[model samples]
Target: MRNLQGRLELCSINTATLGHREPLNQTIERIARAGFGGIAPWRREVEGGDVPRLARQIKALGLSVTGYCRSTYLPAATSAEFSANVEANRAALRDAAVLGAQCFVLVVGGLVPGSRDLEGARSQVVDGISMLLETARECGVPLALEPLHPMYAAKRAVVNTIAQALSICETVDPDRSGFIGIAVDVYHCWWDPELTASIATTGQANRILAYHVCDWLHETNDMLLDRGMMGDGVIDLPAVRSCVERAGYNGLVEVEIFSAQNWWQREPDEVLAICAERLQTVC
Candidate 1:
């Protein structure tokens, strides 16, 4: 296992950790100054900007973009909507490629509103991903499918487990072409009894594309906005990292927290400082 102790070079900051409180340019500067090795920016921050120029800026600052924020929702209520969503995802893929991102993260969406067809939604997700695979390959941008927590199954993502995510990859890219894989976030997956085993499976298949870190608050206030810092919550973060490293995942450790009531309210620099400190000691 890699020793992350006192190694800030292994740390990557997902821009959301600063709560989107700062502009993309400032966020890049602060993150670089904070001595992190990489940064992952969201779609909101990338759209309407000069993408190539921004990519140059990030490269100039010596920070690698670990992954692009996300793709458009895959499961839609109508055929037209699904087609449009797929087009949008293609656009995201192009942007990710232009930005020199390691991969384009896919938050494969949940059921259509007021719909009870869970199986249908899952099928749409699979088909949607299949449609995008060729484009992903053409652009040379890998796809990282992120399975959200089961609590988000109704609204955020139907892909709610690492095993489920890997299954999609296996079905779509049976050869393990490395164009499709999974992004494991601790906040959404820490409760799983099979997490360690799943990580091993993912590693063996060479499908672990990204690894995210954040703690699950025991007394959570809101499902979407109450994430805790690395050591401030209930997750055994170091142990989780051990499982990932032992499974052969030698990638950046991305810190992606969405604490609207807490971390977002603080100064961005302070947040970056705290992330560096926590990553070295506790993660």
Candidate 2:
């Protein structure tokens, strides 16, 4: 395991941690100034123009682009909608390549609207990902499938476990070509009894594309927004980190917190500082 003690270079910041209060350019500057080794920006923030220029800016600041924010939702009610969603994801992959991001994250969609067909939604997600794999390979941008917590299985993501994500990867890239893999987020996965084994399997397969860290509040107010800072919640951060390291993951550890009421209310600089401090001590 890489010792992060006093080594902020292993740390990366996902811009959402800043609550979208600053512009993308300013966010990049602040993250770089805050001494983060990398930054992950959302698609919404990078959709405007001159993406290559933006990439250059990030590089000029001596920071890496850890990963692109996300791909479009894969499951839809209609064939046309699903095709469009796939195309949108293709575009995001292209953008990720231009930005020199390590990989493009995918938050696979859940049950189609007005439908309880969970199996059908999972099928659509598989097809969507299979369709995008060639483009991702062509662009030299890997795809990271992020399995959200089961709590979001109904609306956000149907791929609710690391095992499930790996299943999809196996189906799509049986050769383990590394074109598609899984993004392990502790906030969504800490409660799983199989986390350690699952991470070990992912490591053996060499499919751990990205690693995200944040705390799960014990008394959560909002399922979507209330995330606690590291050391302020019940998750065993060092244990989780140990799992990833034992699994042979050596990538940047991204700090992604979506706290609408707490961290978001504070200044971005302060949040960055605390993240750095907590990462060194607790994480």
For all candidates in order, the CA lDDT equals 0.92, 0.93
- For each of the candidates, give the backbone clash count: 0, 0
Model 2, backbone clash pairs (residues 3+ apart or across chains), number: 0
What is the per-residue lDDT of model 1 for residues 26-135, given as tens digits with 9 covering 90 to 100? 89999999899999999999999999989999999999899999888888889999999999999999999999999999998888999999999999999999999999
Model 2, span 63-176: residue lDDT tens: 988899988889999999999999999998999999999999999987898999999999999999999999999999999999999999998999999999999999999999
**What is the Å distance of residue 12 in model 1 from its true position?**
0.6
* Error of model 2, residue 42, in angstroms: 0.2
**Candidate 1 lDDT (Cα, 0 to 1):** 0.92
Report the lDDT of model 2 for residue 126.
94
Q: In candidate 1, which residue pairs clash?
A: none
